[model samples]
Target: MRIGLYPGTFDPVTHGHIDIIRRACTLVDRLVIGVAINRDKGPMFSLEERLAMVEAECRYLSEATGTEIVAHPFENLLIDCARDVGAQMIVRGLRAVADFEYEFQMVGMNRTLDPEIETVFLMADAQHQAIASKLVKEIARLGGDISHFVTPTVARSLMDKLGRG
Candidate 1:
């Protein structure tokens, strides 16, 4: 089976992320959404919350796309996570050239860590290219409407968590 690892903090899984997930599913037989435990980011949502949201969002993707997409939380190095999940490739979403610079270095390092593993970059949909989790959280915190950027469930959760609701 061709398994791909799409790892991210996914603090609130924005539409941009959903876009990447949908697109990535087309390239792999099995896609594992690895939610990283990056405490450094001081996530608005807990790991469990983030995982739950991702699970709910991606629940139908497997059935619809014919790709088994599962969400897993990992604290180890991404390469280690890939190995643990038997992922042959790592899927990343690039919103702009700025994303390429960072992702380019990341893939290079990942390749060094595990030469057998490969990384594939998928461009974000034009409409979603500007949607980012950080920006979404900031917008929600400031009482901005995020319904357009995220699913209704996530939008409500963000508002409740940020005291904007």
Candidate 2:
């Protein structure tokens, strides 16, 4: 069975993220969603909060898509997380040219670290092309509606974190 890994900070798990996760699942037998604990970014949500939101959001995916989807929290090395999950390919989503440039560099470094693993890029669905976690958080913090960007649980979590709920 082919396994794939989708690694991201997923600070609050945006709809765009769920879009990528669903798209990635169609290509692999199992897809592991790695929530990176990159503390350097000073994430608005804690690791536990991020993981919980991802878990809550993804719980129905396996049954809905007939593709096993699991969310796990990881730290530091992404290649290590991929290896641990037995993933043969790292799945990435490309929203714009900027995303491509950044991901291209990361994919190259990941390939250099593990020659056997490959990377696959998918274009984000047009409807969600502009949704990003950072922007969602900013909107929520500034009293703007972000109900359209993330899941209900994530929306509430973001509001709670920003002291708006």
Candidate 3:
């Protein structure tokens, strides 16, 4: 059984993120969506909240794709998480040239950390290439509708965090 790790901050799982998850599901037997805790980049939602949001979003993904998808909160190194989960591949979504550049470096670093684990990059669907968690948060904070970008649960969570709900 091939296990793939999809690690991200997932401040709130967006439709774009779900798209990638759905796409990755086709290649791997199981996909573990890792909700990484980043201290450097202060998040609008807490780690637990982010994990909860991802969990809720993934339920819809699993139902839609009929794939085994699990979300786990990881405070440790990604390499350690991959190893712990026995993941053979790290799945990433590339949205643009900038994302490619950044992910290329990360792929190299992940390879250095664990040579057995390979990083796989998937291009984001053209419609979702411009959607990002940061942008969704900013727009939602400014009273703009983000219903199109994220799931209803995520939209509500973002609104609650921004004190708009």
Q: Pick the candidate with the highest TM-score.
A: 1
Write one digit per residue (lDDT tens) for candidate 3, span 1-165. Answer: 989999999977899999999999898888999988898889888988888887777887787777788988888988899999989999999999999999888888888988999988999999999999999989998899898899888888888888878
- Top lDDT model: 1
Model 1 clash pairs?
none
Residues 17-121, candidate 2: write the lDDT tens digits: 899898887999999989998978999888888888888888787778888888888885989999999999999888999999999899889989998999999
- Superposing every Cα of model 2 onto the true structure, what RMSD results? 1.1
For model 1, how does the per-residue alpha-carbon lDDT over 31-93 read when each residue is reduced to its tens digit? Answer: 999999998999989999999999999988888999999999999999999999999999999
Q: How high a TM-score does candidate 3 get?
A: 0.94
Q: Which whole-number lDDT from 0 to 100 does residue 152 have in model 3?
A: 85
Every model's Cα RMSD, please?
A: 0.9, 1.1, 1.2
How far residue 32's Cα lies from its native spot in candidate 3, in Å, is 0.6
lDDT of 1 at 72: 94
What shift in Å separates residue 32 of candidate 2 from its native position after superposition?
A: 0.7
Task: Evaluate all candidate structures by whole-model CA lDDT and list the values in order.
Answer: 0.94, 0.88, 0.88
